[model samples]
Target: MILKDALPQGRITGTGSLRTVVQTVFDVLARFRQYMTHPGNSRFEPLFEIAMQKQLYNLLLEWLSGETTNSPDKVETTAVVASWGIFGAAVQWSRDPLHSTSEMMVHRVSEVAAAALAPVLGE
Candidate 1:
């Protein structure tokens, strides 16, 4: 429940350091991968209903707005939307029979998310 824990807390940090944001993103993705791979869970519907997702998106948008001097709007929107897609893909990747491990899926998704947000974060 890392996402649940993180989202309810609000902003990742007051300074909004790019490193912190990136790590947070990585952590979230990792937790998601863990949840998806759990033996008891077979359906994806419950994950979508978690309020944490919306809160996480809003937090990212807020962070993006504060961190970016130019094109904050564009960056926030793209990052938020791209993150949703990336997370979805990560879930799907976890569920895929070909993927042997959740760890690999988490790493791949985290890398892609970092690359996608790096520019906007000014890192």
Candidate 2:
């Protein structure tokens, strides 16, 4: 679905902040793509493992088949697959007792996203 159509339609009339939200989501997706595609980046292996454990890989197949129930159709199945890898990585790391895996993973994703978007943001 287009970003405008991704917004809540009942209580929300206009697109409001959803446009920005979708833009940010797309920017993050780009950064994630770069990270996953790079050969030197060691993050993908662990993330892929997590995705397997979480069954996100299978969900992605279903998503591609247009058999999902809740996700937005316009987001694209490949996008969901990539995002699931990132999210699964976060969950896997968060299981560590010594670190706040969730916070660290979020920080990592945000850092990559900000750097990737820096030129686009003109800073």
Candidate 3:
């Protein structure tokens, strides 16, 4: 429930593992996509993009920093890489109408991310 605890109330609420975090991220991305698609909010798309990336990056940084036992440099690298991977996957998920839902996508992303980070983190 790390992600649930970290996110604001009503954004993402649940208790689980990395799937919870991925689902929360997907929910956030879906909300941002909705906001950006609004005609009045279109002008702020660039700012929203940056904010979303920063938010994910910070969240990953904090999460990985606590989860990993690696050195500072490795942890930082892993966090950056994982954040980008997760963010990129979320972006793609938003674009694909057929796969827009979080049910399968979130778990897949979580598995891939966990696999990628496992070796580096010595988990």
Candidate 4:
């Protein structure tokens, strides 16, 4: 469920398909998590993350280059960057088992999306 769906009174002040876009971002992260923590997985987690990150960055750059006045690209960019940052943190956490930065990244993304959704959802 997305922040807008979870918080009915919330608003989404971003571009089109906010819920769908945000959900996809979350789903990508979920796949990354599965690859990272699972035991005996054939797919290498690091390579998977690197590939995911590249795809995200490419999409973001494309969105940025588009000449739309009201672009969802900005929000998309934020979501992708935050997601990758957190993924990196998760990798570190697994290695050293120290602080958990991945969780922090999730929170940050949620916060932004919540606020962005607030206006639209409140309508």
Candidate 5:
């Protein structure tokens, strides 16, 4: 459901599709946070994290590829960078001392991601 509904096909730029993708990634992470709150308890944490990030990357890739104008190579690269950026910020949000809300995190990540992917997701 996450990837399938990530973005509308074609004309995604400047139409809030990017925000949808970012929100989906955060929503998935928020669900995972329930099970992964304590990373220190597991020995396979590093492997688990890599797998999770890969899933997020694919989610963004699905959205990027929805637009026919994006080249295959560029879609993969942008997805990789944006996924990492989103996941990295999510990790920080989890570790924050003030414990900001997920809504705030989603909004902040959306802004940063839109800027980061402007070349491909924007005009």
Candidate 6:
């Protein structure tokens, strides 16, 4: 429910860059990082993490598939890999003490994600 709301309006129909998808996801999880890391939620953290990753994967699969891309046939693999990268990074970022590297991390991940979806509309 919260995740759905974090997503951009009309993005469920996909039709956008991988960079945007990844950045949007990062923003959402970063906003809710406290919930996942709180002491009271420690017992359910492991299961929550797994479920979150799976949900993101499936959502990204559908979103990527709907995207109009140069490499239409590779969307499945791209989505799988990109989703993992995005989720993993967010988890690590959430645990870190310093946020000094946040923008750098996002840029780096966004670049890799953009590559997978390249010949992507803007570049």
Best by lDDT: 5
Tens-digit per-residue lDDT, 24-56, candidate 6: 666656766667667777777778678777776
Q: Can you tell me which runs of candidate 4 are displaced by over 4 Å?
A: 1-14, 35-37, 68-123
Better of 2 and 4 by lDDT: 4
Q: Is candidate 3 or candidate 6 better by TM-score?
A: 3
Worst 10 residues of 4 by lDDT: 6-15
Candidate 1 segments exceeding 4 Å error: 1-10, 13-52
Candidate 2 TM-score, C-alpha based: 0.28
Q: What is the lDDT of residue 111 in candidate 6?
A: 76
Better of 4 and 6 by lDDT: 6
Please provide, for model 5 over 1-123, each residue's C-alpha lDDT reduced to its tens digit, 9 standing for 90 to 100.
453366676323542766776666666656656666676645655775687788778766776786547789988999899889988887667556258887888888888888877787654
**TM-score, cand. 5 vs. native:** 0.68
Across 1-64, the per-residue lDDT of candidate 1 in tens digits comes to 4433544354544323333444454555556656767786647646553554565576667767
Could you tell me which 10 consecutive residues in candidate 2 have the lowest summed lDDT?
A: 10-19
Q: Residue by residue across 1-123, what tens digits does model 2's lDDT show?
A: 232243454111222332232233343434455566678775665664454434433332333334334344433444354445444544445444145533445556545533433332234
Off by over 4 Å in 2: 1-75, 112-123
Residue-wise C-alpha lDDT for candidate 3, range 1-123, written one tens digit per residue = 334374565232222355566776788767778777767887886786677767666766666677667787887888788878987898789767474457788878888988877766566
What is the C-alpha lDDT profile of model 4 across 75-123, one tens digit per residue?
A: 4555466446534544444455335454454455556654643432342
Candidate 6: residue 76 Cα off by (Å): 2.1
lDDT score at residue 102, model 3, on the 0-100 scale? 79
Clash count, one per candidate: 0, 1, 0, 10, 0, 0
Error of 5 at 19 (Å): 3.5
Error of 2 at 108 (Å): 0.3
Please tell me which predicted candidate would have the highest TM-score against the true structure. 3
Model 5 off-target regions past 4 Å? 1-21, 27-40, 97-99
Candidate 6 displacement at residue 52 in angstroms: 2.0
| Candidate 4 CA-lDDT value | 0.48
